[model samples]
Target: MSAPKVLVVLTSHDKLGDTGKPTGWYLSEFAHPYDVLNSASVSLTVASPRGGLSPVDPSSIDAAKDDSISTNFINSPSTKPLFEQTLPLSDFVGNPSAIAPFAAIFFPGGHGPMFDLATDPQSQQLIREFWDAGKVVAAVCHGPAALVNVKLADGSHLLKGRKVTGFTNEEEDMVQLSKFMPFMLEDKLKEAVGPEGAFEKAPSAWGEKVVVDAEGRLITGQNPASATGVGKAILKAISS
Candidate 1:
């Protein structure tokens, strides 16, 4: 059988809201998951709302410096190019067949996604296509922001009544970047999923947490610490 193809979407936004600080996709969130899935022979296609070069959050680089996989993802010739020249998300919009070959879609997060992916109509439509096609949909950290605005063909929120998790409010507070964020990830996820939907979190800030709503074909990781787990979960879900 052919290997499963997964679409990995990154953020094109590089600036933190009003802080004048740089922010893009978190290094560990993308690197750990990429390493996990790539090692398992999964084919990954990287894309972004604006395409072209996808920026790496500067803070994540410093934070993930000690992580060998993250370090290698940056220095490795093969992986570096994936994010360096991402396909434009617009390529998949209005073309269901363009995304049909992929078995799953993943969104790796940073504050940048909170600004762009969260509200990008193209990103929302792409995600809806994946969901409507019965494909796996996954995200980590602030990546779930992308789903908050996604609606099904029936006009219901895609996340409605699905179990999910993302960067917690406590974690955001710990980072001291809560004020800069447009909305709290935890709250938005809870709201999107609605009353029946459960939004879970780790025991403590930054703890690893991964949630797989199998029925929904959705997987989510709470923080960067959960990135590898999310990837493993996606691999399992797709392979099954």
Candidate 2:
């Protein structure tokens, strides 16, 4: 059998909401997961909403210096090119054959996704197609924002009655970015999942947390720290 193929989606939005601050995909969130999965021999494809260069959150760059994997990912010749030009999400939408090669879809966050991916209609449809195909759907940090408005064919929210986790309200407040985000991730996820679905978090803010609703074909990570775990979880899910 061939290695599992995964589609890694990044945010194209670069400006923070009204803050005039530059923000894009978080380095650790993308790099750590990419390293984990790629090292495991999984075939990966990187894509975004705009089909071109995806920006990197400037703040994450300095922070990621402490993480060797993330640092190498940014400077390495082999991996840095992945973000230079990403396949647009539209390429897979309405084209079942286009999406057929991937076994899972992943979204890595840096507050950028909370803006574009959260509201992109093409993204919603692509996710629905993946879900409807029983493929693994995963996200980390604010990436879960993409799922807030996704609905199944039966007209019910995709997150309904599912247990998931993402950037928590507390973490947002701690980072002092709560005011800048269009909507709090934790609140929106809780609302999207409804009462039947559970929104969990780590014991402390910024702690690593990875939620795997394998039966639901869903996986999520709480923050950048959870990226590696999320990738590992995806590998396990697909291999199983």
Q: lDDT of each structure?
A: 0.93, 0.92
Give the residue spans of candidate 2 off by over 4 A. 214-216
Model 2 weakest lDDT span, ten residues long: 208-217
Error at 52, model 2, angstroms: 0.9
Candidate 1, position 99, lDDT: 91
In model 1, the clashing pairs are: none
The superposed Cα distance between candidate 2 and the true structure at residue 144, in angstroms, equals 0.3
40-65: candidate 1 lDDT, tens digit per residue: 99999999999999999999999988
Candidate 2 residue-wise lDDT, 167-186, digit = tens: 99889999999999899999
Tell me how far the alpha carbon of residue 60 in candidate 1 is from the true structure, in angstroms, after superposition.
0.6
